[model samples]
Structure formats: C-alpha cells, structure tokens
Target: MAILPEPVTLSLICILVMMCVKILMDQTKKNKYHFPPGPRPLPLIGNMHILDIKRQDYTFMELAKTYGTFFTFHFGRAKAVVLIGYEANQEALVKANYDFGDRAPMPIADDFQKNHGVIFSNGETWKITRRFTLSILRDLGMGKRPIEERIINELQYLNALIGSHNGKPFNEKVFYNATPNITFSILFGRRFDYDNPNYKKMIGIIDDVVKLTGQPEAKYYNVFPIIKYFFKTPGLVVKRVNELNEVLHEMFKEAQEAKTEDSFRTYSEAFLQKQEREKATETTEKIFTEKNLLASTFDLMVGGTETTSSTLKWAILLMMKYPDVQKKVHDEIENVIGLERPPKWEDHKVLPYCLAVMHEVQRFGNILQYLPHSTPTDVSFRGYTIPKGTIVVPLFSSVLYDETKWEDPRGFNPNHFLDANGKFLKRDEFFAFSKGRRVCAGETLARMELFMFFTGMLQKFSFTPPPGVKKEDLDLTADPFFIMRPKRYYVIATPTI
Candidate 1:
C-alpha cells in the first residue's frame, strides 16, 4: 500500500479522534431519570437468578422486604422499575398514567400473535379494540336482561346439582364447574354438558396455559427472542399455545357458520357481522377480521373465566374459615330475601354485609400482580423522564394490600369494605377493575357475573371444611401468573338446613 500524504493523514487522525470523543460523551451522560432502586445485579443476566418462578410471590415479597416497595430489576438486558406500594402504584398508575398503560410486546406473546388482541395489544390497536369491545359487550347484553336471564338459568341448574348431593360430603369442585360453564355459555352462546370430554380437555388446557405463564423458561424466551429460532426441542409453552389455537379455531369456525346480520345471537356474531359490513367499504386495514375475533374471544374466555371463578372459590374458603362472617351473610339473605326465593341482583343493594364480603373477597384475592403497560410517547413523571416505549408496570397487587390504605393489610377481612355504620363502602382506591384509559374493558360484565353467581351459590349451600380439617388448615398460597389464584384443595358443600 502507498503511504498517505501528510495532509490526508492529519485529516484521518482528526476524524477518528472526534468519534472517540463523541462515544466518551455518550457513556458519561447520566440517565437523570433513574429507575426505582433494587438489589444489585450481575452483568448480562441481571437479576434473573434471584427469581423463583414456582414461588414468585414469596420471592417478590421477600425482595420487597429487603429492597423496599419501589425497586429496580433487570432480566437479560431489559431494565424494569417495579412500583411496590400504594403511593408508588397510584402515582405511577393514575397520576402519570399517560407515561405507563402500554403493554410490553414480549417475544413469546408476539409469536402467538397476541399483540393484536385487546388484552395484549398496545397503542392504537388497543385503544380501538377496547372502545369497540366495551360497546359490543353492552349491545350483546353485558349488564342487560339477556345476561341476567343466563345467570338465573345457570343458578337454577346449580341449585339442582347441589340438591343431588343429598347432604353428603360432596367435593365443591364438581359444583364449581357451573361457574366457568356459564361464562363460556355467555361468550359462545352455547354451554357444554358437565360430562362432555371436550369440555374437560378445554378446562385442562386453560389450567395448563395459566400455569405455563409463570414459568421461568417461558419468561426467558420472551426476554431473549433469538432462543426460539435456534431451539429444536418442543417447549411446554409451545404445546400450550397449540392447544389454545386449536380450541379458538374450532369455536370461530362454528360461530362463522351460525352468524347472521340482523340479530345479535352471540358476541362473536356481532363482531363478524360488523367485519363483513366494513369489508364492503374502502378501508386502510381490517381490524375486525377473523383472527382478531378468535383472539378476542379467547381473551374474554381467559380473562373472565378464571378470575371470577377463583374469587368465588376463595370466598367460599374464607367463609368456611370465618363462620361468624358467613353466618351474618346468610342471616342478611334470610332477612332481605327468604329461603324460598333465590337472591336476586336487586337484593345486593339492601344486603350491606353480603356486598362487603364480595368486595373484600376480590380485594383479598388480588388476581393481577402487575398490570403491564408501555409508554406511547415520552412523558415526565415525578421529576423523572419516562422514555418512549419503556414498559410501565402497574403493581395492582401491591396497591390492594398496602398497609396504609388497609386496616389489616395482611389479613383477610371483609370489614375493610365496611364503614363505621356497618354499610357497604366503595372507595376509588379500590382499583380492582383498574382506572384511566387502559382500565379493564369488561368491568360491568365482571361485576354482574360475580354478583349473580356468588350470591346465587351462597343462597343454596353452606361451605364447610372437610372432615378432620380446621379452618386454619386451609392453604392460602397463591400461584403466580397473569392471575394469582389459590392452590388446589377440596371443600365440602353441604346444603343449608
């Protein structure tokens, strides 16, 4: 190679020196907006080793004790700032909601194409789907007579099922099927017989899917997208996804064949009809297509099914533990609506203690741990700069159990929802349905289902602990996932005398 001229060499040296200086400046630039503090992390893996997926709650609670409520953590290369107390949660979730509310598009969820669905979608798609879903739900009888009639029918069938027990020590799980079955019926405009094999398989798939969500390996795949391309072995998460997809496709195919334009037979039909009409007109894109329909229906089935059912299960368990509270609820029902008539939705207004128990059950259950969202654009919050696209997690669980807000945060107490005069009280801080623009779209439907199914069941049966088991023996351990539910156990459902 020929030697460079003196002038050219000087110019080349200047360029290289400038590049070095620029990089040095960038490295030294302080991230003025610091994330919440947490345990010191290692390089590459960050705080990955500290997490125990199977017992995530215990680990996180312990971590909170050491690191305080507001803390920072890292998984792989991604940094997460966790808000752990009521104040931090409220400040981040409500006050600076615009900075927070967007769900992070994790890789495994993206592989399942969940980012397009309302539950997982971010930005414009979420906003549009959320608005449309709420409107359609109202039209399809979420808080209307149609849904009310369905709940009453379900209660009638369950009353008969409980009658069949003949005061024997029957396991409550058998009767619990009615709750999820009714939810499915409302969603698909069809119900599965309790003995149906397909229905059993579907329930099993849903349970597995929920369990896999809290798996460390599954989380690892999300944090590191490249792992999926290279792996040849079938992952547990992949199998769960396949099972869910099959169920969704079958349901959608049936809905499509039965759909009509004039009447709203089902939620899916209403969406399909709208999609067909929209197709005729020139459109930028089709948001109401079959894929979105399938995903949305599946989202509803997942969101509505497990949460309310689990809460009901926990309520029964808690009532068994606190006999005095359960007795008070039963006495109130007897005083307001006699044993001959079933507890109707209208009676909820008059029965203060019963309503408080329901609210307390949901509050104590605390299904969602961290409701994840992402920033649509750059936002400033509490003197910190929240960059665009940063994943903002709303720690709803922390808020529900905050010591300052609750009288006995660690204990299960229905009195938390009661006032000085023994009337049912409602607080804005009770963000179980969440708040702001990204709050749950199915709040009304959830409320209706919880009230109808819960009061209906309580009226017909008395929940009691199994033989040789004390109320204190019941397990309160919750499994970590998208929803936090109690560990599996059997209970005795005895008929009320």
Candidate 2:
C-alpha cells in the first residue's frame, strides 16, 4: 500500500468536512420550516423509485390517500409540493393564486419555449401575453355569433369529409385534420383544404411534438437534464419546434404585408399591430416581440388544436360504447333541430341532454391530467412553509375522480352533469380546463367547438363499433401519451337521415 502526501491527505479531509457541514445546514433548514410530509426518498433519485412516471397523476392520488392532500414529492433533487382534492387545489389555485400561479419549469419545454409563450412563461410575460391573447380572441368573436358562424361553416367541410367515409369504418385520427381547421380559421382568417400539403405537414409536426412531450424519455429529461447529451427525444423536440417556427414565420410575413390600420382581421394581424405599437412607444417595455409572436402562436395553435380534437374523438368513442346514451342524444337532437336542419350553437340551450353528455365527455375523458405550477415566493400554504420556486402540481385527476364529489367516480355516467329534472347541472368540481388565474385561455372557444361539432355529428350520423367488435370490447384505456388520448379504434358513422 502506498501512503498519500500530507498536503493531499489534509485537502481530502477538509473537503469531507465541508460536505458534512453543508448537509447539516440543509437538514437544519428543513427541520426549521414546517414542510409537508412525504415518503422517504433515497439520495440522488428522490422518490422516483416509488413513482410511476407514466401515470404520475394516479401515483400522486394514491400517495395523497396516505399523506393527505398537501404533501412534498421529490423528483431527483427537485422538490414539488403536490396539492390534491378540490378544496386544496381550489385554495392554492384560486385563493392563493398569486403565490402559486407561476408555471413550473420543465427541461424540454424550457429549452424550446425559453419562457417566451403564454402557456409556460412566468411573471410579466405570462400576464401580458395571456391578457393580449384573451382580448384578441374576444375581439375576433371567441364567444360571439361570428365565431359560431365560422364553426357552423367549418362543420360543412367536416361533414363532407366524414360523409365520404359512407358508413365505412374509419380511424378516429381523421378528426385531427378536421378539428384544427377551426383554430386555423381563427388564427389566420382562413381555413386550409383538408388535403393541402402545408396543412398536413403542420399537423404532423404538432402531433410528433405532443407525442414526444408525453414520452417517458422526455419526463426523464425533466428530472435529469444531463441525459439530453445521451438521449435523442429532447433534441428531436427542439428540431420539431424549429420546424413549426418556420411555418409560423411564413404566416407572420403574410400578416405583416396584409396589415391595415382600419380593422383587425385575424389574430396574427392584431399581434403584428400590437408589435408595431410597442416598437413605436419608447418608454414602455416591449412585451410583444417577434419571438413572442412565434411562442404565442405556437401555444395557441397547439393548445387550441390537440385538446379539442382529442375530446371530440373521445365523445364519438363514448357514444359508440353506450348506444343508449347515443339514442338519447339523437332523440334530443331530433326533437330540437330535426334531421333536415343543421345544428347551431343556439340549439344547445334547448338540448339539455346533449349539453350534459358534452360536459360528461370532458370530465370522463380527462385528456390533461395536470399541468405543473410553481410558487413565485416563499409562502405558507395550509400550515406548510413552501419555499420560493417550489414546483406545485394541483392534481386534476384527484378532483375529477374524488369519491366524495361524484357518486360514480370511476364509472362513465352522464348523470354527473345532469339534475334530477333532466337539465344541465354545472359542477364546480370539474377541472377539465383547470382553475383560477391559469385556467385554460381557450375554454370558451373549446366549449363552442365541442357543443357545435359534437351535436352536428350526432345529427348527421350515428357512431357505432366496426362490424364484429362489440361495445364491451372497445377499450377505454387512454394511450400512453402526455395527453390522455383514446387509443386507435375504428368507428362506423351511419347517416341517420
């Protein structure tokens, strides 16, 4: 055995002492603060050994059963405070919104967005961009008759495409192409033909981005960012995002050339006008920039398209699974609007059963389990002193599936949104679009699309399982994507008229 030099030996001893002191200080600070209790975590990995990364929402709910609604969960060295149940999520998201409203940083999204967009950005950027977006959407007829007319018109194209199937079994993915056109019309002032190459390319890129974002490898990158050097998913995500940005830039150029001082025709035009105004003003901070335009547009295009389309797909699947419920919707549509006339947004008011079914689909489908939020400052929440920048996840699945809130929490029953007298009963517990200040920016438009598209489809056609497949054989299990998308299945749409 060889002996080390005295200087090197002393240096090694000093390093060990310093590490010990640092650990002691950290433990002391943790003890001083009343942090929420959680399961024991091992060094470096935290609670990853115990967690199911794919179905983290389910794992969080199970842990909540033991640790109560508020608990600390660790992903590697990072700390996340999980808020479960309606009361806890409501209190944090609504009551203490300012304290818990920041978007939690995820490695892949941060790398791509860089805090530029509405969905993942924080502080002033989030506030200004979100406010601007809502205003633009409102001005462009988000909840008004203008948008309703657009949806009704788009329905003609969608009906034609679906009718082309001629009662033959077709993959539900076809809805992806149709549903996004509603969003495109709002964003660019025109809709693309279903077969246009650019339209197909854009949707394909968005779908790839969504699928990659939901993969386990992407989640691992969030926990261990260093893995990006070895992993291909993160790099692929950035490449796809850049491709999307290229498509958006072309539209931006068109919007700039088409801009006018008289009136705002599209979302892109309004944003360009705002960008110019910010540039002209010397004193004010320029919230609207070229990068922001790309980020905001990306957020709107992706967020607006995927979730609405996925929900519509689920609605059709559920209708096929339960023909009795489909019959009720069909009967309601026949009574209110009949077979000859097209279903309008106004018809939803008189169609209570149809309205209930729509709400139930959102609740039962549960496409987005939860989007993580963060604390902007150190704050006391329910007797726990959560530190600043702590990742906070308000588990939406818990609220949606709370046994205390719903009589049939695990079952698919439309009565959850219906009163005994057969009217649409709005439940406060439905967090499908999330809650509070960070609630989905596109909620109103989604409601319009869902009601109009869903009712219109039922009016023209009845959805059923393919030839030999029984309703019981139809799988309700969501695909392993970041969003809870229904797995690929074939549906037969027979024209009722």
Candidate 3:
C-alpha cells in the first residue's frame, strides 16, 4: 500500500478524533436524560435522510405514529423535538408557553433579522415589541370599527379591480395587490393605489422573499448554512430583503419627518414617538431603535399580507370547486346582508353559514403549517426532557387536521363548523392563528380582512373555474412557499350583483 503524506495522515487522524468526541458527547447526553424516542440519526445528515424537506410536517406526522406526539429529530447535527397533534402542541404552546416561547434560531432569519423583530425575536425584545405592537394596532382600530371601515373602503378598490376582470379567467393573485394595502393603511396611515409603481414593486419584493424563503433550498440552507456558500438562492433572498429594507427605511424616514407632537396617525408614527420617549428617559437600555422599527414593520407587513391573501385565494378556489357550498354562502349573504349593502363585521354574527364557510376555508387552507419555537431552558415535556435551546416544531397542520377533532378532517366540509340546526360552531381545535405567547399578532386584522373580503366578494361575484375547466378538475395542490398558497389558478368572477 502506498504511504499517505504526513499532513494528510494528520488531517485524517484529527477528523476521526473529532467524530469520536461527538459520538461520546451524544452518548453521554443520551445516558443523562430521557430524551424523546425517534429514529436513530446517522452521522452528518441526522434524520434528514428520512425527511422530505419540502413537506417535513407530513413526514413528522407519519413519524408520530411510531414515536408518539413528541419525538427527537435532527437537522444535520442540530437536535430538535417535533411536537405533533393538538394535545402536544397545546401543552407546549398554551399550557407551558413560558418554557417553549423563545423563537428558534433559524440561520436565515438570524442573517436577515438579527433578532430585531417580533416574529424571530425573543426575551425582552419580543416582549416590548409585541406589547407596543398590539397596543398601537388596537389604538389604530384593529378588530374594531375604524379598521373595519378601512377594510370596507379597501374592498371597493379590490371589487373594482376584480370587476375590471369582467368575469374573464384571471389569476387569483390579484388579491395580493389589495390585501397588503389594508396592512399599509394601519402601518403608514395610508393605502396605495392598486396601479402605483412603488406599491407594485414593494409587493413584488415581498412576494419574492416569501417564495424564496419557503423553497426547499431555503430549508436546506437553514440546516446546512455552508450550502449558502455554494448556492445563489440564499444570496438572492438577502438581496431582496435589503431592497425591501430600503423601501421600509424610506417610509420610516418619511414617518419621522412627518411626525407631530403627542399625536400618532399610524403604527410607524407610534413607534417613533415611543422611541423618542425611550431616548429621553435616563435608562441605559435602548429598546426602541431604528433597527427594531424596521424589523417590526417588516414583520407586520409580511405577516399581514401573505397569510391573509393566501387564505383569500384558498377561499375563492374552494368556492369555485364546491359551487353548492358557494351557493349556500351566497344565499345566506343575500338573506342576511343582501347585495345592496356590503357585508360588515356585524353581519358575520347573523350570517352563520357564511361564517361557517369562512372558518372552514381557514381550517382547510392551513396556510402556515408550522412556526418553529425553542425551549428557553431545559424543558420536561410530556415525559421527555428537551434540552435548553433545542428547536421545537409545533406542527399546526397536525392540529388543524387532527382525526379525533373533526368529523371529516380531510374533506372540505363547512359542516365541520356548523351544527345540525346550521348554527356556527366554534371549535378550539381550529389552530389557524396559532396559540399562546407567539400567536399571530395580526389575528384581529386578519380576521376582519377575511370576513370583509370573502363575504364582499361573494356578494358581488359568482366565482367559477375557467371556461371549459370542470370544478372537479380544479387543483387545490398548494404551491410550496414560506406561506402555503394555492398554486397559480384562474377563475371567472361573474358579477352576481
């Protein structure tokens, strides 16, 4: 046998020693704590070989059959405890929220946000930012009549845009342009015209960032960040993120210049006023910085836009597929609110069938399958000890589709939310906005947007699959993105009014 060079032999010896040390450390950890049982991980890749990166939630559900609700899964060398089903998710997210409230350290988010925003931030930053955000949103009329009027006003623009389609087959992404303006109305104290160039550019950038972040390659980058050195998509995402930041910074500057004393017109203005107060105080810590402002604004904009628009897309798509159900919703709207007057938030209480259909759309859409959380400290959960800082994935999809919770979990049945007498039934298992400390911040706004846009659209238009396309042929397969959205599909919105 040929003798290896001295340097090569030394490098091999070092690598072997490192691997041995890792094995011994893992063995020691296994012996020390009763970790959740899962498939044994191989070196390097861990459970990734068994996981479908694009649909890890589905893979985790399958794994739950063997490992039960909480199980250990590895992403490369990183350890994670996957929480499956409603019980497990509730236990971690609701009952023991404090223990599992920290946002997991996602490499991509860290690279982009650096723990500055509400979504990916933790500890005091999260607390302060979230508190201020909720207050400002409420002050600006989230979940109230002031915001409802804004949504109602925005609906006119949306209706006009959709009506301009003239019942021709048009891609449902047109909703994307209108939905963010609702968010913008609160954030910047204004809404953009649908045809505005800057508005279109901002939406396009957000669209690209969300889609890129959801791609399987993005998941791979999170697991093995070294891949970013070889891959271009991650770099592209950062570039787009920077472009978005530029837009936000410009808006921030505008808000600062346009500020008036003791008066707040928008969320941005509120945050700036708060920042000035923080500056004037004698405290050493600065909680409300420009970085935080930019990040929080980005979080609200993206959060407010993608999920609502995606849910609306699903609502329209599902209605087209199930015209019978759509007709019932239409008849309910006609009987209760009628076409002459647009649907209001108050109408939801009277329009049980319409409300049921809306709930069913959210349940069936399952736009956000999971958002990863982390244990703030070593957590004793469901008889398993998950180490501190371990990533925990509370699979929301599993909760939404839990077999024991719904009568027909797989089918698109609005009856799931309806009683025998057709009254709307509220199920706790509908974990659409999530739960606990990290529940979606814009839940109220999203709820208002969904009710108004959905009912309003149904009031004016009758949606159907494109000409010659059968309802049965309409595909509901979700496009893989950070937000699970219906694949690009066309619809004919015949004006019913």
Provide TM-scores for the models. 0.90, 0.94, 0.94
Clashing pairs in 2: none
lDDT string for model 1 (208-266, tens) is: 77767656555667667677776532266567767877886777678889987687677
Q: How high is the lDDT of residue 262 in model 3? A: 91
lDDT of 3 at 243: 90
lDDT of 3 by residue, 1-497 (tens): 99877998999999999999999999998776667888999999998999988778789999999999888898899899988888988888999999999999877777888888899998888899999999988888899999889888888989899999877889988877778998998888888988788788888998998888988888998999899898888889888988988888888888999888899999999999999999999988688998898889889989999889989999999999999999998898888878977788988889998888989999998988798999898888777777888888999999999998888888899999989998989988989999999999999889889989999989999999887999989998888788999988999889995
Candidate 2 yields a Cα-based lDDT of 0.89
lDDT of 2 by residue, 191-271 (tens): 999888878888999899999999999998999999999989999999998998888889888888999977789999999
What value does the lDDT take at residue 410 in candidate 3?
A: 82
Residue 188 of model 2 has an lDDT of 86
Ranking by TM-score: 2, 3, 1
Off by more than 4 A, model 3: 1-30
